[model samples]
Target: MKNLKGKVALVTGATRGIGKGIAIGLGEAGATVYITGRTLEPSDENISGTLLETQQAVIDAGGVCIPVQVDHSDDEQVRLLFERIETEQKGQLDILVNNVFSGVKEIGNAFGQPFWKHDPSLWDAINNVGLRSHYIASVYAARLMNKRQQGLICTISSWGGLSYIFGAAYGVGKAACDRLASDMAVELKPDNITSVSLWPGIVGTEEMFRFSEKWKTEDEKEPQNSTMRDYYNWETPLFTGRVIAALADQQNTMNLTGKVQIIAELAQRYNIVDENGNRPVSLRSLRFIVPSAIPALKKYPWLIPDLKIPWFVLQWTMLQSPKI
Candidate 1:
């Protein structure tokens, strides 16, 4: 990827996981990155990482890092965050990564649970931070990008948006994220700003590794019951970050605006590899999933038939059911 020297970037939820990885990647490429998260100190024990940790990682990677403690769920905090950036950077924001997400902690192992069985409050957990926060951040980002008439807004979405991977709330939130990028691109296009949703296939973050280890332990008791094997081929968070940085550096990025891109395919095109120096497989290839014409189909549901299949059959075939 081309160097991001002299660029200014804002990465939300940078305390841990994919957000942290992306912040580090941008910093390594020589961008001054402002990272935001709820966790202020590395000593905070509630989460696996803190903003201070990510800030240090970015600085260690040879980029200037500004750590901010902002809860994305709070509209006031989000607004203030942008104000600070605008004042400090003089309206020169180059990249805005909408990576903040919540509610996963509440989901636990309820990936396959029916919607009714889960807590109703889970909807707020997912949408409030993931969907609503993205929109709020984009509003401020658009203003900053419009000032310079060039910028990239990337939302870290998932395959779950295209197909059912987890339960209803997760899928809904991700799907909204995809749509958010698409719609935002429409308005931002005239200003030379691009908004895109990126889907990473099975990232091996610290949280995911913990989940994998538990599944591995369960697999010992019943060999066929575990799904941990698939995670072995997972991509590192930095891989997606590389893709984002490359996209921002591309001159023709406007052409890709409003598209939902798969990280593995982008990696192949850009010659990107994970931390282990291996190409990650696309989730579409693994599950025989294909990108759906969601917006178009939503307006015309009569185009396809909706069939209710047994859960076991759905799992065995890896075929996603129609959303209708």
Candidate 2:
């Protein structure tokens, strides 16, 4: 725990998965968290989690939680969300976590298919609510933060931005997300607001389990494929959230602005472990990723110490990435 007693945070898409976990994690650090999502209560659909549930979980984690229902695709609703927060928190918005993305189902449907095979609308499906929405939310948050001349805006991105993890639409959206943070930081830095993209290692979230199964099925079809789709050694959603909480509470937040921060590395920096007392694997840690991908080598993972790939080497993904 980082000290965040009087901070006010807004985490969008907090009904489930990462958004929910981040809200709870911020709550755990003693911030007054406001969670926004479409589902307010239990629904008839198979998808689990609701704002009511996330609110209770956040409260249980030892912070105040307020739930708001909003359809992010609507600009009016998004505007109202910030207005309400300003009214409730009295012009004080300390942190913003943009975690809303409705493209999972679209990606699931188009998994492994080439870019040409996908409909042009695929871009809208992913970026409209994800990449574009993040910018909108940042606009509102920045306004509040600007008034105070201080704030933190964290965009949950992925390694997919550097390498091809999912598909074209996803890769493009994620890459743009990183760029958004980098560019935003350039403008916000003078005001003392921190902005950056965060890349979490394979997060062990409920939806991720379902998403990885898509990979398993695809990997089965191509036994020779080099890509790995296992989540056995991935980080918990809360761990990623915890990293963001730590990011917000940092004394010199400007030092980390304008770049993509890896959640795994931040975990080590902050000495954070999941609630189960386990440290999640890092992509560069050959020991962890290698064993997680090839279960046969699982037992040997602990033998190797934690080491990260150099930034220059990790950035060279064009040749290494599959040319599909």
Among these predictions, the greatest TM-score belongs to 2
- lDDT value for model 1: 0.79
Give the alpha carbon lDDT tens digit for every residue of 1-324 in model 2.
538999999999999889988998999999999998888999779568899999999888888999999989999999999999999889999999989988878887887788789889999998988999999999999999999999999998987787776788899899999999999999999999999999888777787778766566654534213233544566778998888888887888788999989888888898888878888767777766466556667656777677877777767744475432
Model 2: ten consecutive residues of lowest lDDT: 221-230
Over 1-324, each residue of candidate 1 has an lDDT whose tens digit, in order, gives 328988999999988899999998888878889999988885636667899999888887788899999999889999999999999999899999999987667666565468898778888977888889999999999999898999999998986775665678888899999999999999999999999999987788887776666556552433222335444346788888787777777777987899988888788777777777877656444221221322223334344443333445644454555431
Candidate 1: regions farther than 4 A off:
44-46, 109-112, 213-227, 286-324
Q: Tell me the number of clashing residue pairs for each predicted model.
A: 0, 0
Q: How close is candidate 2 to the true structure, as a TM-score?
A: 0.93
